[model samples]
Target: MQKFSFNRRLVIIIVCLIVSFALMTVSVAVRNKRSTPPLIQQFGNDIVGLTDRIVALPANGLSGSVSSISELLNTYQENQQLKKQVGELAQTKVRDQTLAKENKQLKQQIKLNDSLTDYSAISAAVITRTPSSWQNQVVINKGSSAGVVKNMPVMSGSGLVGRVAEVNKTNSKVELITDNNDSANRFAVQITTKSGKTVNGVLSGFNANSGQITMNNITTKAKISKGDKVVTSGLGGVTPKGLYVGQVAKASGDDYGLSTKLYITPATDLSDLNIVTVAVTKQ
Candidate 1:
């Protein structure tokens, strides 16, 4: 029974092959005789074309999707690179601006040193500053070895900022004018009015809220006005004469009404101290 079944399959295959060859021969003969294909051949061609289109649909769609995904990934990578570059550029710009500002301040200090012909200038970089005592004091890299001594006036940027409070071998602590301590040193400041009258007073305290220095004990009611320039009076032989202190922001009657207390705005930013100059007056 198995042998008969195998023989039947072989016969069916042979018959199909013979029929296919006969059809190919007839198709070629028909094509030579007529411009149009035979109806049977046309039907077979239609079937093959339809099958090819149906098979290619998913393949074409998958190819398009793959291409789109590749393009999307590339674009995302480019965007990330661009963002990194932008961030780096922004950081560089900020650094450059900071450097430029520091350079300008250094130049101004150089000019200040040149103008102080009577006193020798000791330039020092601010080495230490605590947030709690930022306005109160700062430590400089210069010390007693470099002619930095206690009570020497320390100037930053353009004007007087502080005085040497403590001196060490390699460093010194400077007490700023904004120090509110009761034992803080007071500056003998004088303001020259528009009428050429010099009114002298002691810079006693600082108003932290208003960021202004307070001057009390006005010797005479000299009609102090805004924009009046204040300078060191050379009194007590501590701070030198002609050193710029600040400008008068406002003036009001003192507690006893016998004198006026002036609120003076500093010429430079007291909070942002960098390189400072210590005026070595005695030496």
Candidate 2:
């Protein structure tokens, strides 16, 4: 009985499919002949139209999704391109600024060379500074090959900075005037008074806290006053004449009260040095 029921259902399904196919065929034939379709054929045409409308909804949605994905990909590519352009622009700006700074330094060096007509100028760039407790030493890119020698005076834009302490073939070291080592740091300086009388003293020490250099060992009767222009006396041959040192900021007696001491503010900004000129006397 169960097998008989299954067979009956299968036959019913096959008969329904055959009837639907026949109705579609007749509908096509009638439409081609330009005749009105019968009732069954018209029903088949209506069913096909409804099925096409249902299928077209998902097809249209798929096409819209593909278009949105393509647009997103284009947007991502454009963003990446813009980022690359910005990076290139930043690099260009840095290069331009560096060139401008170097040009300004060169022009200043030319002016300094013209003013100091007495000494031959050998321009050198500062390579490094001393990292030890003695911060008064610097290395320059000039050496004996460029005629830089030991005890040669080094000057920046404002005034004297230091003296060449050691010279190699391609580099040299400068001992700044503020060096604590007494034997290598003394300078014979003269202060020009308002009355045209010159009072000479030795620059032997520096006060780091006060930012002043000490010109000590002066005679008790020396008439040194504040605001006097101090310059190299040219007594020793290490530094030449007329090189500006500083002005006398103050004057007082020594710690022992035996001699007078003049405090001077250095003309040059010793904390910052970029380029310097080595004064090499003409042979």
* Candidate 2 structure lDDT: 0.75
Instruction: Return the clash pairs for model 1, or none.
Output: none
Error of 1 at 229 (Å): 0.5
lDDT of 1 by residue, 1-283 (tens): 9999999999999999999999878855654454335455545544544455455556656866988898887897899889989999999999989996776688797874422224668998775564585347776777666887678788988799988876665566688998887656788878999889998878889989999999887859578899999998877776777788889999888899887888999988998876899987752
Model 2 misplaced stretches (Cα beyond 4 Å) = 1-117
**Candidate 2 weakest ten by summed lDDT:** 30-39
lDDT of 2 by residue, 54-163 (tens): 66447656766988798897897888999999999899999989986776688697864422224678998776677887658887777676888777788898688888
Local distance difference test values of all predictions, in order:
0.78, 0.75
Cα TM-score of candidate 1: 0.57
lDDT of 1: 0.78
**Model 1, residue 133: C-alpha shift (Å):** 4.7
